[model samples]
Target: MMRAELAQNFRQLELKKKLEPMLPVLDFIAWSLLKHNQDVVSQLWVLSKQQSWRTSKSIPNSLWNWICSAVDEVTLDPMTKHAWLLLSDD
Candidate 1:
């Protein structure tokens, strides 16, 4: 159910051209992590380290707010707390 929802969200972002080319890959990583496919998730993380893009300002500010809200949600998850911590440390 969660994977489907995430995939739907990804599809919308892709259609809007609001996501990077690596986003589908990132979506896979997120879905895999949530599904306990750590090996695949780790591999995606490593691959992401090699990618770069020009950050754009045209993205809606509401999207940034939504990201913050999502991060807040993730922070409440025990399994995802580490990711939140790493984000905070940065």
Candidate 2:
């Protein structure tokens, strides 16, 4: 499913040497998050925090704003919309 596809994408990125020094940490975080079956918002939050900490700077507001914009562009079904609403409520 989505987890397998994401893992494959990560592997492809890694093979291109695009991840570099952050690869191990990013991979571990991604796998752990996927294993826990966390929601997309939660995963993004954790990844953003990790990226900020790894880079020794606060994550840019623009990055999160962009994520929001991207999410807004998706045409969610009823169940998905409900899930998104619940996440937004939190």
Local distance difference test, per candidate?
0.53, 0.57
> What's the TM for model 1?
0.23
Q: Candidate 2: where is the Cα deviation over 4 Å?
A: 1-25, 28-36, 40-53, 56-70, 73-90
lDDT of 2 by residue, 4-61 (tens): 9999998998877765656556645554556455467556666766776455344444
TM-score of model 2 relative to the true fold? 0.21
lDDT of candidate 2?
0.57
Model 2, residue pairs in steric clash? none
Residue 70 lDDT (model 2): 48
